[model samples]
Target: MKIALFATCIVDAMYPEVAQATVTILRRLGHEIVFPSGQTCCGQMHINSGKFAQAEPVIAAHARAFSDTDWDVAVAPAASCVASLGHQQPMVARRMGNDALAAEAADIAGQTYELSQLLTDVLGITDAAADLGSYFPHRVTYHPSCHGMRLLRLGDRQSDLLRSVEGIDYVDLPLADACCGFGGTFSVKNPEVSSAMLADKIRTVHSTGAEVCTGGDASCLLHMGGGLSRFQRTGSFEGTPDVTAVHVRQTSSTDVGDDNVDHLTAVVGADDDDHLTPGEKGTSPAEPSRIQSGFRVGQSAVHLARILASTKEDPLRVQSEGATVSGGSLR
Candidate 1:
């Protein structure tokens, strides 16, 4: 099959490895891969921030970029970006009064697929280890991005592929469907709420005791990895007390101010371990034991494409120590 790769802005600029991995996997599957060089941001950020006017050209460029390129199908590693192709592009073009561009946008959206959707649905890849020679012998957990889960309705396609990886101890993340709080500009405009949501996610990830947190979207993983990195350094969330566990919950109908509206409450200094039995101190009994911190010193965020692209011959290195977070990049 001939495939055009839609390397999203984040993957193209910040994490080219992920794009390369998408190419690698396709090439490995005996498919031809082509890059549409004119591709830029899918205008998700603009559309998400209510800048529809700014998104018109972006959506037009994306439609033109892929339309000009000859391929049977287009695939992107980022589910959010792919979701935008179908969900927002046409609407944005129509709103701009460019019916021609809107038609083009709709056509392009139909041809685009998230990497896992292409792999599992189009290619019929049930076993990653067998079909793609995917091998990653490490403890890992997956976070399903919101766009992938809610918009794309890509249930189990990503995680199913991960579970098929050879020697991969795939652990089911608690509240796996929860958003990582990196909703593009949503995190920027609402930093406090984002941080609080991130804290809960990081704590859940810590409980999994996985060496790496993998996800389809680089943005969410980046958000999570940064939070985990900070926790690894300071051993606690910012302004959070040094407690065994901090439970953040929403108010229930029985006791709270308003019944309809929910409120976030942080119960600090709770003994999370007190309820566990003698042997279940760190382990969840159903899954692995909790690691000392959210993630180990060198634990890092990795894209799903990179993990799927991994093979026994040239395995992707998993860092074990001396990890650092700088300039909002997690390493």
Candidate 2:
């Protein structure tokens, strides 16, 4: 299959690794990956901010970019962007009385899929460890972004794939379906409300005791990561920034850090057999221990693909940037 990559603005500028990793996954599956050079933002920010007039050109550009390319499917790693493509783009075009653009936008939206949706539904990949050789020896909790959950109704597609990864201890995040409060301009225009929502999300993540928090949207991840960074500094709810922000870093296996001696040894580089429960060892089952969660978010397709790729070359580890936990940095 020939796949065209719709590298969203956040992933392109801030999180390029996620885009590259996406290519890695598709190539490993023996599929061709094409990047349409004319691509830009899907105009989600403009549409969300109630600027339909300004968004038409963006939506038209998106449709034109893909229409000019020859590909079987167009996929993006971010669900929010995918949601905008399907839910917002055509609506915006029609609102602006661009019937031709509306039809084109609708056609493009039909062919677009979120990374997880493509992998699971179209590619029929049921086991990440077995199919993709995914290995990450860290406890992980997943956050399903609002657009993916409520709008797209992705419904556990991301979490299910993560759960199937080899050597991974998957924990259930409390209120996993709640928004990270990164609704594009909503975060900017409603700082106090956004922070309160983020605080609730961060608290739930902290409860899971997992080292990594992942989701389908880079924007939400950026919001949550910044909140974690600021909360660690101020030590209280002091102020809020009514503006959008993002930080990105290139990460490899070595960035997981050496200071976490016990956790590093226990989870990282462990064999598949090491994950077996006591019941499987001919012993009485021990009571289940609750895992505390952290503030990691938005690994997207590349991050997920590299986890599998690491199993073949280097073992996967966490980085202190781009969705780092509390007391960690995102750059």
Candidate 3:
């Protein structure tokens, strides 16, 4: 399979490791990976921000990049970006009175896949451990990003893969399908509502007591991670340095458990006030943190294919899986 890797703008700019992991996993599966450099933002930010006119070229760039490529499928680690390709791109094109561009955008989106969609739907991969040697000995809770869950309709494809990872304690999250409020520009435009939603999410994450929170989109992870960082900063969250968020952006495919797991350690235990940059981390001192202690925060990506592609033995032990509690239990 010749797969064109559409490293979304966020992944390209902030989380390049995720793109590398995506490539590493596909290559391990004996598939060739293609990088279409012409690709840029999927125009999701512009469309979401009501800048339809500005989004036209971004949509054009994405379509043109994929149009120039001769690959079986185009894949992105972020579900929101992939969803934008299919959902927003065409709408923006039509709104701009560019029917041809709309048709082109639709064609491009039809061939693109979020990582889990490509792995499970296209490649017939189900069990990460049996098929990819995915081994992560940690308590994990999954938060399905809004776009992936509602827009892309990915269902349990991502979580099912994580559940299948060797030595993984996959716990169910309360409101697993709820939005993390990182609607690209939506968070920036509406900070209070965004912060409220984030507080609820962090509270639920704390209830799970999972060492890490895994999701399908880097943007959401960034939002959730920012909320967690602020909670840690103001001494709001009273947890240990173990809980972190892992955006299965390509998942543990590169080194399965080790790299992402190690990355999580860095994210959660980071205490340098300098590390708590406001805009970059997606947090602010104005927002009150309700997350308790023994629940630090971090972020990473784990590739599903690489979890089963390796020849190494499975290292998971299925420790007590923590269930995400919401509502009354939250502080």
Candidate 4:
């Protein structure tokens, strides 16, 4: 199988290892790999930010880059980006009123696949240990980015592969379905709310007591990792240091888990009666912290993501086997 790799912006810049790992796994399975240098981003950030005008060329660039390629399939490590190709590309093109571009976008999207989608759906790979040489020995957990879980509906393909990895200790992350407070520009625009959300997510990560956390989106990992790194750097940046920055886009929802999260109290307009910013309220300087710490929601995403990421790609009959260590202990 010949595959063209879509190195998303985040993976291309910060976590190229994931792309490389993806390439390694596919090549080990006897798939030929090619990379499209013209690839930059899936225009997800632009799309999500409601900047349809700015995203036109980005969309065109994506379609042009992949449409000209002659591979059996195009694969990306991030589900959100792959989902963006199918879901947002046409929307973006249509928003620009470019019927021709929209059609082109649709064709490009149809050819793309998230990493797990390619591995299981196309390659018939069910066991990472046996087929992909996935040998992570540390106890790790995975967080499914929102777009991948909701928009792409990739469902459990990645998690199944992780479980099948050789010598891996897969711990279930708590409150897995909850957002980690990194919604791209939402973070800076709504910093306090984002912080509170991240706090909840990081607590879940810590409760699992895993050495590290993993996920399909480098943007999410970077957000969570940045927070975690900040916490580690400050020995509790406000509260903790194990969480970081989050991804800033969306993906398809494929029954990966429960996607029902009511707005947090800290979120403006969460209730019918709009509320003021934490600072705007007459509450003391210290009161805002308590309000944020008290909020509890979105606890199911990680678990739901892990489960959804394991199998169920086709949505008709999806079944997968979870990976477990056989007499293999984490140090």
Candidate 5:
């Protein structure tokens, strides 16, 4: 398949390595990649900040860029951006009263996808370790960012892909659905709340005992990594600014996600519990866990009526930044 790479602004500036990794993984799989040099921001940062006005031109740019390109599928390493395209872009255009542009944006979104989504759903890559030459020989925990989880409704896709990776010891990310506090411009606008959330996240990540925190969204990683900085002993920059903010990094356990160590081996203390966002679906969470009760497609929505009724009357609050389409999995 011919793929158009969505080098999200964050990846272009800070974590090109992620784009490179994405490219390597795809090419090794024998897919052709096209770099649409005209591509720019996906307008997520603007739209998420409530700057929908400023987001107009960005969305148009994206529409024109991709519309001009002829590729089998457009793939992005960032889930948030892909979610914005697939889900938020139409709202952006319609809100601006650009019905024509809104239609165009929606069309583009329909054709684009998050990397793992394309791999697992379209390409039939169910086992990463078995297929992708992927080898991260370290104890790693996966954080499914809010947008990817809620907006894109991508559950288990990222985790399943990681689990398929060779040499990867995939441990369950305690409170995996909890926000990493990177809500686009949300962190800058509401710094305090963002910090509080990040602190809670740091605590959970540290408790996981995983050496690395990996996720598809760069925004969340940046927030968590920044908070980890203040606690760094020397206070030296851990990675490049964009690197610190975009690419996944080693979160400091000194304050949040770290438990401790017996010299070389790091460890998360016991007392593991399931604390997914106040509400949202979980991939068979750690037991005694609460979830968004209704299934989407695969299974019959047995209590669908009650779940819909309750959520409508008292909108179940979700702590995470995402939610997937109902019942798309069980099918």
Candidate 6:
């Protein structure tokens, strides 16, 4: 089968190894891989930030890029970007009153698939170790991105693949469905809230006692990894007291009602100093448990594609920077 690789902006610019690992897996399966050079950002960021006018051209260009490429199907490693192709692209085109472009966008969306969707649904890959020679001998946990879970409805496809990996000790992440608080610009705009949510995710990841936290979205993994790295470096979470038990209501807008605000305040409790934010400095702190003892201090955040592409001979190694696949370093 001929497959076109849609290396999303993050993957292309930040983590090209993910794209390369994706290609490696496809080629290992005897499939032809084609990278459409005209492809660029799918405009997910623009659309997400309400820049519909800016997103229209990007969505159109994405459609044109894949349309110009000759392939049976297109696949992207990033679930959020892929979800935007179907969920937001056509809407943006229609919002611009471009019916023809909207049609093209829908057509492109139909042809595109997330990596796990393509591997499991299209290619019928039930066992990663058996089918793709995936071997990751480490304690790993997966965080399903919101776009992949809610928009794409990619249920258990990624986790099941990870579970099938040879020598993998797959542990279910507590509150696995919770957002990692990296909603692109959402994180930047609401830094405090985002940090709070990220702290919650980091605590749960630490609880898992896993050496690595793998996920389908590079953006979320990047957020979690950066938070974990900061925790390891600073040895304390200052300026994030709300992170102790503050559950940021996952809503579209900032108009959280009194009930929600009350709920948020109610959940805030005094815990160990490790869990408390800087604001709760005077709170009576409990003894630090194993989850806070810096056991997985240098825990790695890896993309699922890299894990899937790993093998016994050419295993993906976790480095200080990130994971290296096939001896090629990722920047």
Please tell me which predicted candidate would have the highest TM-score against the true structure. 6
Sort by TM-score, best first: what order?
6, 1, 2, 3, 4, 5
Q: Comparing 4 and 5 by lDDT, which wins?
A: 4
Clashes per model (N, Cα, C within 3 A):
0, 10, 26, 43, 19, 2
State every prediction's TM-score relative to the real structure.
0.83, 0.77, 0.74, 0.72, 0.70, 0.85
| Model 5 global lDDT (CA atoms, 0 to 1) | 0.62
Ranking by lDDT: 6, 1, 2, 3, 4, 5
**Alpha-carbon RMSD to native, per candidate:** 9.3, 13.0, 13.3, 12.1, 16.8, 9.3
RMSD (CA, Å), candidate 6 to true, equals: 9.3
| Residues 98-153, model 5: lDDT tens digits | 99999998887888888888888888988765676555554556778888888888
As a whole number from 0 to 100, the lDDT of residue 295 in candidate 6 is: 47
Best candidate per lDDT, number?
6
Worst 10 residues of 4 by lDDT: 312-321
Worst 10 residues of 3 by lDDT: 322-331
Mind sharing the TM-score for model 4?
0.72
TM-score for model 2?
0.77
lDDT of each: 0.81, 0.72, 0.69, 0.64, 0.62, 0.82
Tens digits of per-residue lDDT for model 4 on 10-122?
A: 77776555676677667767889998768788898888889999999999998888877788889888877888888888988987899999998898789888888877888
Worst 10 residues of 2 by lDDT: 261-270
lDDT for position 198 in model 3: 74
